[model samples]
Target: MPTLSKLVCAALTCLAVQLPAHADNTDGSFQTAPSFSWWSGDKSANNNATGGGGVFGGRSLSVDGLINSAKNLIGLPYRAGGTSPTSGFDCSGFVQYVFKHAANVDLPRTSRDMAQVGQSVSRDNLRPGDMVFFAHTRGGGNRISHVGVYVGEGHFIHSPSTGKTIQINSMDSGYWSSKFVTARRVTD
Candidate 1:
């Protein structure tokens, strides 16, 4: 039977030979090229420095990353028309900030306009990274006046009205469920 060292060497030799071309050393030892990354072919690691996907652009958007980004802003106070972390965020501003920062996708500044940008997604089919819109009963019927990033499990993150901080609320909650206007998917 082959010794463990020999088996490992044989495997490495096969891998090195199968991988992309790289400079060969005079010594018969295995040397992995910088490009020879993800031995298991897992692309989920965003920045492994050895060939993980780079964040940015629509092609690289990660739903988990986007949801995490929105969740990180929880507890931030809401300010009317606010657009940045320093200034705090309103509903639409929170959605805009999360998408632009996490996925490099710029969104309209207002919830109503944002509702027009992406393909409509039914509430039953809602997925993480989808933008969930809402309209208050007293204010414009069916007009989207609020926006949040769905974090899955029927929960969404948003910076609600004045004096309220960013928070995660259940879409099934009486207040929010009744207010839900529609959902849109801005990323794949």
Candidate 2:
């Protein structure tokens, strides 16, 4: 006894409700946040507006924001000793710029100083926001001569060279992996 239009409306409503929430429009794939809730309980209380507290609090947000901001500058031209996007940037300059803008963390001008500022961490234990140092074109037993931000999953973002643009490179890549020196974690 229901009208045809009413029947179609009811069916559509049921379908809509049954569809999973957070489904991507492009492919209708369901997406979920990683279970790790970086911020919780006491940690949340300690993370003031200034972004203090350890990695468990707003620090994670800082890392994520920094990574996102770094990714946004994928094609920026590399300029030696340049810090701002307007002037372009060198490797350390690019890292400093991203951290300053995204996490409000000011880093030293040179890669060597930047490496000295943070706590040393092993490559196997590196987390997001950690710094990865390398010798670049240097040969054996040489000190670290380059640095990049570890954005996670064995990948890093940096201003590679004079003519190269700011971009992500795989840590597993022979060129990079062979040159990799060490990793450091500046923030908790």
Candidate 3:
């Protein structure tokens, strides 16, 4: 239920108050923020230090900003048709909100609809901020039933299904890597 600016401020406040002690982040993992715990899965494997390597993962770009904004909403709940941070968000809703609010890009409402736009990219070609899609079924006929914003390395940020909060997941291994239908570079 926290806004991006508010979250940023809160993060800054936490940083100021805890400036003397930096948590040991020696591994390629992050524990995510406390407030974010409510919204994300908070898995160390997903928050690996590599953060999912992407072609444009280096030197933050506008897309990188969008990626960061989505990552900040790590602890929001999933609402069936929700799109805002306060009410929570679904997979597509999460993608829609991030594009609209962060990059000023207007995307379709449904994950399938979104899959239709943008330039198609191979899994090996994905860059930070590209839209990644998944089909719930593994059948060749299955269509895009879910979507997320690619955040680099092999991770993505998405508001998962009911009872699940926004979280990051790996694209190189796991059910996702298998269900991945295709990726699209929605932005330059």
Taken over the whole model, the C-alpha lDDT of each candidate is: 0.70, 0.68, 0.70
Query: Which residue pairs collide in model 1, if any?
Result: none
Which stretches of candidate 2 lie above 4 Å from their native place?
1-61
Per-candidate TM-scores read 0.68, 0.67, 0.70
Candidate 3 C-alpha error for residue 92, in Å: 0.6
lDDT of 3 by residue, 1-188 (tens): 99999999878656633433223133222235322321233444233223433222233236545866887787689999998998989999999999778766788999999998878989897766789998885465558899998776676778778987787776776667778888887664
lDDT of 1 by residue, 43-102 (tens): 452222113322333356767567657755766889999998998998898999998898
Task: For residue 34, give model 2's deviation from the true position in Å.
Answer: 18
Model 2 per-residue lDDT at 59: 42
> In candidate 2, what are the lDDT values of residues 98-139, reduced to their tens digit?
877877777888898888876899989877678899886635
Q: In model 2, what are the clashing residue pairs, if there are any?
A: none
Instruction: Return the number of clashes found in candidate 1.
Output: 0
Return the lDDT, model 3, position 36: 36
Best by TM-score: 3
Which stretches of candidate 1 lie above 4 Å from their native place? 1-58, 137-140
lDDT of 2: 0.68
In model 3, which runs have C-alpha deviations exceeding 4 angstroms?
1-61, 137-140
- After the best TM-score superposition of candidate 1, give how far the Cα of residue 168 lies from its true spot, in angstroms: 0.2
